[model samples]
Target: MLSSWFRVIRVKFLLASVIAVCLGLAINWWQNQTIDLVYAGLTFVGVIALHASVDLLNDYWDFKRGIDTKTKRTKFSGGTGVLPEGLLQPNEVYRAGLIFLIIGSSVGGYFIFEKGITIAVILAFAIISIYFYSTKIVNSGLGEIFVAIKGSMIVLGTFFVQTSHITMEPIFGGIVVGVLSSLVLFVNSFPDFDADKAGGRKTLVIMLGKKKASNAVWIFPIIVYGIIVSGIVLHVLPILSLITLFT
Candidate 1:
């Protein structure tokens, strides 16, 4: 069952979330030398839990709304694992998501209690964005901006909780992660274009059509890489090790 769940997550989506976690950890580690291991571990777990909650809730919501149909989702194929295929009911998926969300929020609340007040703002936005993404408010094309903010907030919030200070470095790194992760959403939007349109989900791809959505997918990576290279070349960011290549 554990292995099946792992497979359900899918490598691409898992890797993307892993990358976001790495970006958060990288920023925190870079800025702090005496960070607590337990705190860091909790943050890591929080990130993963939140990722799972988002996926599971999305599956549950999509299924409920009839957005995930038999054609769009296969028995072993779409919207996580068992949920869409009728192997699991909506209540089960909803319960799993709630459990993970509680765990994540517990860790996050701990960090907030230890950290300063700045984290409250980020947490507020994070919770709101997560809720609204698939809800009525997000179906009007505003979810893209929320997603971008979500990506950026991970790094900023991570740094704030760990270091208890804010700097421009994490801000820069946040933008990079925000834009790259946004690209992932942009591409994911492509195949779901017609469905999204049909469902009245006015997401970016739904509004732009296939051609412009494809253009966005290609353009985002270019712009992100350009910013990364520009920062390194202009000495805005100090030369680190080979890890910089991936960033």
Candidate 2:
């Protein structure tokens, strides 16, 4: 039962949020040399909750729309096979998604109270976009954009919560993490191109066609490396950050 829930939550993918938060913390520590461990831990829990919400909600909707039924399942692309296998009920998943969303939002609410309107705005955007991501955002072809922005905000929000201010360091770091996050979605879309199209979803893969999309894959790495190199050149990111390129 626990494993089934974990599968639906896509626990492995939650690592993206972890990386985003860590990037924000790393940037803050680089600049300020201090961190609020309590806030940091809370941020991780909140972000993970929201990430789980989005994945769970995505699975629910995909199954509901018959999209999951059409796509050939893969480790990366297709929806979790939980529903199709009757391991869980649709309403149960939907409720769990809402619960996670509320848990995440509660954490965000606490931050907003502590950090002011900045956290408020970020929380609002996250809640609204996350709830509608599969039903509307994906259908409108803005899924990739939303994902990029979400990742960026996680970094930015984490930094703001700790430092009570914004900086180019977090901004640039956020973009690198955000773009890399979107790349995951972009690549996954490739395998689901046919089902996504049939289900009235318009992903980057569908918009560009598989052939063009394949060629376009190079753009993601380029953006990530460009930002990293530029940040190092500008001295915004530490020289040690260059080690990321080796990965």
Candidate 3:
């Protein structure tokens, strides 16, 4: 029973959560230990919860939007539309999503209350921004940029949470991981573009023409990573902190 329930938690999505935690670990390491195990673990759980909500919310919204209609069977996802799969009830999915969302929000609220404005303000913006990024509001119109931005925030938030200040290190690391993360979002969209367009999903790809979108799929990451590596080489990231590369 436990193993069966475990399937509901997507491994790939969990790996992404691991990456976020690793980012926090890296930042904590960079700052020479401003965060200890308890705080870091809690914060990592918060990050995982955010990623979980994103997966669940995205699936629920897509199901509602007809993007994952009968013709569309499965998506590369954490939720995987289990309701559609007949493996779980709709209400069950909702409950799971809500549970994760509440836990995630509670953790974030703790950080806000304890750490004050810097992390709190940014997290508030991130929540609002990402929520809209999946729904009709910001999701369709400014898809690429929004995805890129969320990717960047993993690094940004990690840096600030540890040091309580923003610095060039996070900026550079943000761009690197940000572009990689954005690339993941961009490419994953490709498999779904047809269904999305069929379902009247007006994503950036649908709006700008898939041709441009395809170019962007390639161009955006390269350019962003190029800048990041260059910054590292030019000593913009501080040579002493080069240990960041391995972590």
Computed on alpha carbons, the lDDT of every model, listed in order, comes to: 0.69, 0.94, 0.65
lDDT of 3 by residue, 189-217 (tens): 66677777776667666676778888777
**Tens digits of per-residue lDDT for model 2 on 1-247?**
8899999999889999999999899888888899999999999999999999999999999999989999999988799899989999999999999999999999999999999999999999999999999999998889988999999999999999999999999999999889999999999998898898999898888988999999999999999999999999998878888898898
Stretches of candidate 2 off by over 4 Å are none
Clashes in model 2: which pairs? none
The count of residue-pair clashes in candidate 1 stands at: 0
**Measured by TM-score, how close is model 2 to the native structure?**
0.97
Candidate 3 or 1, higher TM-score = 1
- By how many angstroms RMSD does model 2 differ from the true structure? 1.0
Please report the candidate that would top lDDT against the real structure. Answer: 2
Model 1 residue runs over 4 Å out of place are: 1-12, 70-78, 240-247
TM-score of each: 0.85, 0.97, 0.83
Over 53-143, each residue of candidate 1 has an lDDT whose tens digit, in order, gives: 7777777777777667632543333355466566676887778777877777777888778885677677667666665567664487876
* Model 3: per-residue Cα lDDT at residue 178: 63
